[model samples]
Target: MKNLRNALLLKQLYQLKQLGYKYTSVTPYKEDEQHLRLPNTLDSLKKQAMECHLCELSKSRQKVVFGEGDPQADILFIGEGPGTMEDSSGKPFVGRSGELLTKMIENVLLISRSEVYITNIVKCRPPNNATPTPTQAHTCQPYLLKQIELIRPKIIVTLGVTAYHYLTGDDTEISKVRGTLHKQNDYTVIPTYHPSYLLRNPSAKKEVFEDLLKVKELMGK
Candidate 1:
């Protein structure tokens, strides 16, 4: 009986390891509950983020764009990463693409940009605004995950394939996955084309608008 029990315990630990969870004194199952109980104020999270060096992106970042908007917002917009303008100002969504995003919020959602929280997969800008490598994103993913846990938004609108892939771990292209409603953790995720893509191909804006309307509908519920 003792040997059988020991074998079962080893199997349980192995299963936890396979699921990417570290068994500690506190146990892996309580990780989310513990994080939920932590101080989730934006100011506190931003202060910690300012000192973060979890990934190489931090080494080259001019500024860590932690994110900005209503802390208690029911909606969150996540982008790929900081752009040149956002890096310059230490804010998210302030460039040409940001302008488009703001317009969409106003025109489609009938809400001001300030009404929703906006952030990115990685807090720092990638070199020359390239897509963030998977390693960098994985290293910095905890912060975004914490933000989501705190905000507990009704809807999460992921702009671009990077954000979609980061949150859902789904490699589907944005063109293929856009407009589909996916459930991640405890929130509804809606993937759509990034504003930069819409800038290059204005025709895709119609599709993004359709996605945004879905966000509006979900938020209403």
Candidate 2:
């Protein structure tokens, strides 16, 4: 019976994804009230995130890079995990790649960096900037889901392969999925290369810009 129920929920989630209705959970927060008190505000959520130790990453992390930007923004930018700069600053997207991302938001989306929320799949930085293991992602996913629930952004731009994989549950390469508009549950998810990748490749900046243009168009709609 439990297995069957799980399967049905998964089916419904997939259907919602197809229909473009992005949200955190099919069941309301009330169902899990005993386990967690879902915060109605981003600040409260950040407080919870700062103390989280659900995974091993927490042990080595200097600080939890909770995320930043407008709590009520219409867009959310999710990346994989934090690197050295992010870990040190206890913020997301404050490094070189972050600077590039800022430019992307300003130049293409025509919005200030503060207009959209920015976060990562994991709150803590993985050691030496390695990819987060599935266990780590699974443990931290609830926090992100709750963030999505609270903010309820109209559009979510996933900024790399890891972010795309975590959000969409799709294992395809970013190259194939980039610039595509996918429906999660209420948000339209647009995947693109991480700014760090663009820094290395340089050539891919054009494609990232194109993806941002699509994001701008979607926002206007």
Cα lDDT tens digits, model 2, 84-153, are: 9899999898878999999999988988999999999988999989998776776677778888888899
Which residue runs of candidate 1 sit more than 4 Å off their true CA positions?
1-39
Report the lDDT tens digits of candidate 1 across residue range 1-221.
12223323444565556778775453322223433332457688788789877567788889999999998899999999999999989999997999999999999999999999999998999999999876667666767887887888988999999999989989998899999998877889999999999999999999999999999998773
Q: Each model's TM-score, in the order given?
A: 0.82, 0.84
Model 2, total clashes? 4
Q: Compare the candidates by TM-score and give the number of the best one.
A: 2
Residue-level lDDT for 208 in candidate 1: 97
Clash number for model 1? 0
Error of 2 at 21 (Å): 36
Q: What would you estimate as the lDDT of candidate 2?
A: 0.84
Q: What is the C-alpha lDDT of each candidate?
A: 0.84, 0.84
